[model samples]
Target: MAVPEGEISDALQVLRRVFGYDAFREGQGEIIEHVVAGNDALVLMPTGGGKSLCYQIPALVRKGVGVVISPLIALMQDQVDALRNAGVRAGFLNSTQDLDERRVVEAQFVAGELDLLYLAPERLKVASTVQLLDRGDIALFAIDEAHCVAQWGHDFRPDYLLLSGLHERWPDVPRIALTATATQATRTEIASRLNLEQARHFVASFDRPNIQYRIEPKNEPKRQLLHLLRTEHSGDAGIVYCLSRNSVEKIAEFLTANGIEAVPYHAGLDPRTRAENQSRFLREDGLVVVATIAFGMGIDKPDVRFVAHLDLPKSVEGYYQETGRAGRDGLPSTAWLAYGLNDVVNLRKMIDTSEGDAAHRRRLSVHLDAMLALCETVECRRVQLLNYFGQDGEPCGNCDTCLTPPESWDGTIAAQKLLSAIVRLDRERRQKFGAGHVIDILTGKKNAKVIQFDHDALSVFGVGSELRDTEWRGVVRQLLAQGLLAVESNYGALVLTDTSPEVLKGARKVMLRREPEPTKAAKAAKTAKERKAPVDLPSEAMPVFERLRTWRAAQAKDQGVPAYVIFHDATLREIATAMPSSLTELGKISGVGENKLAKYGNQVLETLTPA
Candidate 1:
């Protein structure tokens, strides 16, 4: 049945009044209408597309409290906090709350005083929780991060598999499962796992036009990081992702010591330290958090200026979701990556030796292939990344390729040579070699590792000498990126997959882009130029803009957040330049949402026209 036109508009009023959002973001209306009409939905919304509101508004307009199966305690807390702050009666039952607190929240939910109740997926399997849901008028059963239900998803959680039971318990309640990242294979698995086979699929475009995707060769990771900090992110909040705990520590310390206000966050840090560091980042302006993947699962910071990857993520899905965290406010942001052969070898080895069935292994190998294709393609990075998620569209000119195309080379022969090395290395004995050793054998390096192992005698050795070690590394990295090769996670072994056969037989030809030299000129240009002020601003109000920024920075520091939370620099610049004197005028600023206007809009006016 089609949604009644009047009801949809009524829902819009609720969205504005309770959530303070004057307008619905793209794709939100359709998803909301579908869920509110009592139908199952699989929503693939990009980050900051207002996916939360799709279910939140529906839950409020529906008959009963929506049961949200969520992933983390921190995320649930953030969600609940945001909802409560919006005047929505939302609460969550998670391990983090004390028993009394849980009892109070549970009572409110049971009394139907709550519009939404968040629960971890693992909690859903508990007989008591299941019984509670069966007894309540569950208007909807919503699963956020629904891709976790899939075995092939990047952040797969074992608990998510139990969510299929929600369908069995509340067979009548409409279920809406949502994820920001889901490839075709993951989409299929999510449907089966959630038992939402007949659900409507709301796969929004994954393109984030605001982010500028850039991948640079690993000339010097630390220097590159400092350069990014000094030039691109002088007073911005961003994340620097590293592979190891040690790297996170060293990088955070190095940046902090060099006068960059950075903090370290990784699994190795104590929970208190991690929380404190995260709080500092969230509540302070100009703070950088160097972390492992543990830091950003459910971060709600809207204006992360840049996301720099010191290590290549495991798959394209992982890469997209991680980078999507930046530029969430729709302003221009940068997505930078430092690529190297070590990342390739490590990722390949992990998938090749993982303890899984052949089908699972092959599935993983396919994901790696898509990731490799992404890193090597001269096409728009956003285009390829979205294409991986089944979003086929035109190239977005926001990425490096659209800005400046890279030099491409036909890597057919090089690909064949690399595959041949994998075959000769023996599939079962994968862990004993590294990319350097393999490349040595391929180019006949006469290195001790290759010579000692007699890999120098292999027929494929030296035949690929036309390429330098760096070039050969690119070939192997591209092969790994293309899913023809993988590293064994257990022993760090490089292993070739079945796809290697086709490439070696010349049935497949791969194109690879040569990594470009570091651009010192671009670095110089950015460093020398001041942050540009908006041209349209009134001349008299320039001082007001500076005062607003100073006030915003102080407010953000008090909250332990980056300045963007208080107001984006672009928004503040526009405010000062435009010189909006009233609430009406203030709301017109680019990033001034109703919540922001209500809480701080008057203060902005006061600061602008002080007595």
Candidate 2:
């Protein structure tokens, strides 16, 4: 595994000279050197963990252009812009480009003038594209977002299936596959599908400590989201995820109406509008993009301060992938989600009604079960999240549970009450009821529905009045989460599962977490924000930072590139804090590579002069 001394040195130089990083972060050195020595690797690093460097540096140190295969055509422009800003000769070929544009990039590739070439896996299906690649000298094949190759993965793309032929075609060229997150099972599947079983595997710890994970009960979710944006993340760039496209449009409108500049993105959006919205979100500051799972794959925007989810995610993998998009520049960020009883019932019903066989339905159910466990757990959210990915983590004191530890109370009687009600309705009335009707009958409500059904006539009816309506709802949700309750797919009625008998007969103990009160939850959220690891610039330097941002925005707009493509917020923060008086001093800052310093150094110095 020893990389030659010269190759290792060259990798470090490229990392310093081109990337402006003084040293490698954790396992990056090994990966970069391995790829530099023309060895295959499968890397699983956390998002914002400097993953791009593992391949980008090797491409610079090696002899030929690095070819990257990805399906995120929407982001190739930004990625190439950033690389080109860093002085790397990068070009991309995707459906978005015209024939003339493709010819220009193809000429660059054949002329050996490009250091990196980006392509969608679908483009490889075209014989002309393959022939064009064959005419160029390739240093390595880097499969970005390699997790997509997993058939059961959260973000599977069939085009990724074509990537397995890469190694077979370019046997002499080194190939490396990389993903920000992957469970061990998914890891095995990715390796199997991509023909990388023999590749050396490197997994970094799947912990994003700067991200404070928090989940709350869904109570007027739209208002809760509005409060989160107004109070904590005011004027910060962020993302809000909704489960449906309809919800996406509504949420985006709601935010915009409430004085937040927001946009909507989903599969239903026309291609031009979707592209425009994506472009605006990337290029603008303090804008929120409400979207479905369709949006965030290859986004490299570093200043996204929060990622909020209105509905429950179907699996922990999808949740992790979506939330990981925040704080890509190593800044403090928030990953917040709100869930409720209906979410559980709806997800289960969807699984049961899903278009799949028994095995496929079982797999989908398993993913949902894991997701529910994450939502209902009283333990640290980060611990549960990391555990799902087969990685271990200490209880991060930054999450909601650790901040305001919830109480786990015995709910055996409560469970029996709900289950008995369901049983009574089924046996006595020969009918089933949803959670609302069941809760009403149990709570002694003599409303029209109960009066019409005469549900109060049953012995169990009105017998369980100790718990309030919300408390009873909580019990039902937890039971469903624990598999003691099941939801019928057709009518969304509550039903008992095989395990419900254990709880009903007092043979099993049911434990449930009591959610924090409104005030307590608000205080905990505020405390988390206060206790966050600071990635802020000094107050004295704030003016300088803003000026630099203004200058950078103008440059970005003029050049038709995203602001981060010019320089990240983190880089700006570094510059302001250092208050470098000269170009030499500015070049010493991390992220100030040779090209950027050369391009923006005088302007940055001029911008700082007034401050």
Candidate 3:
């Protein structure tokens, strides 16, 4: 079933007339070509890398409806809505739809009225659903968020494990599995589990240079978050991720109290309330979502200005995927985090106490260690992140490290002192203690526990008095990150690993990063300037942008959809900058597809016209 030459021309027309893009982004054309040729593909593209177009254009060019297996029901609706708005015949069937609605969509699919159909994986398990799908002509099977199939991934869905049935049932249909985040391990698991082992793999660059990475020590984290919102990301849409439901509620309340429009979202809330909060965050401009890990998968919002983490994430892959949600429109965005040693201890305790075999626990430990390394790395954050996914990149100047280089000092003595304290406490007292106790002993702080245990007279006691309390904490954190120190899972006790002996014997030299100074006024000013509207519209065009936004908001409200569904801020900025006077001129601008131009052309022109 090779695509005819004329159909290729039709695909290009759909790209321009329907999708409003003149040319294909990098790797999109290749993937589309392969799919149109009825080949399987495994695409590992970054967030905001235009992955939808890879399967979308090919679906239009081919003869049958494209069946996209999405994980989330909400995501399916969002995609279907966007496609319908673009004038594509797209529909979705999920649990949310009633039998009548499902039958209507099924009739449309059977009648060849739909260009694309979205389905949750669970639907494929039903005999009736399978019979319905079997009766239709499926163009290809496109698996969105393919990484969910990996058992080790953070967002693994039990339903995704059933996706392999697609290949077994419809061997003739070309399949394309796509995800925004996947490491080498996760990629292999996705390919193997989804029966895409023979599929051609396309691994795009994992770097998102538009996002500026910054990690600060947790000191009055709420105040720090407020400063970030007020000073850097004023009047912008963003997400705040906490580790617990209580924290999400409190933070959301705190933000709202401070005059910032914020909403809370977590699994603990009523489903309707969570849905409403998510809807508000999506529909309203400048509304922040304070949520836990339960939120933020498959979100299509493109103008999020920042993603702030109130606590440390579980793994590097998780951190990368979460932070990658920001600056998705290729605008300068920030990924700010406030973390301290408590995050490490808490995460370790979680891993240790969780039900798992030794092997499973070991894998979890490795993932956490990688995340901690990223947080503690003195080198380029982007480089470290990319390297974790098996990509090589130079220092990205946008990250905090490259912006303000931190001084590194040889911490061999500091390491020996800490290891010595751990070993002496264990051997002499037959007791294991956490970092705080070790630091107390090292800095000559004879608290009641130390005096009670007679640890005030240890040989290593007071040996590390030269370094401050914060500095010692840094050393211990780095040691844990480097695997020289391990936290016991059950009791949260710190223990030495095999690597600790090397540092204790002076065979290995340790380097620790000096904590960066507080954010200065000059730096804040520079960041504020950088966080302005991404478009380069002239000063005179500012009013036009505002007017366009107002019109878009009205349209979105009328349609009960997110404003970006009508037109993204980037598209509006383009329209304002270009100031196209005619429908033809408006269609020439990117993102103004033929359907949109026909639908809103007159309104846009009237808005642009002089009063």
lDDT, candidate 1, 1-611, per-residue tens: 67766778878878766654567888888888888888899999888777888888899888999988888676576567656645678889887889899888778877888999999887876788777776677889889988877878988899988888777767789999999998888899999988989999998888887777888767688998898879777888899999899999999989988999899999888888888888777666567899998778767778688899999887888888899888777777788888888877776667766898989888877777777677788887878887777778787655666656778888888887777777777753343566778788877788777777777777877888788888887777777666677666776667777788888788988888876555743643353233223233577767887788778877756654455546656677777777786898777666565667788888898888877
lDDT (C-alpha) at residue 458 in model 3: 94
TM-score of each: 0.85, 0.98, 0.96
Tens-place lDDT digits, model 3, residues 210-231: 8888898887999989988998
Could you tell me which residue pairs clash in candidate 3? none
In Å, residue 566's CA in model 2 sits off its true spot by 1.1
In the predicted model 2, the residue pairs found to clash are: none
Local distance difference test scores for all models = 0.79, 0.90, 0.88
Which model is ahead, 1 or 2, in terms of TM-score? Answer: 2
lDDT tens digits by residue: candidate 2, 477-554: 999999999999999999999999999889999999899999988997788668653655678989889998999999
Ranking by lDDT: 2, 3, 1
Cα error, residue 520 of model 3, in Å, equals: 6.6
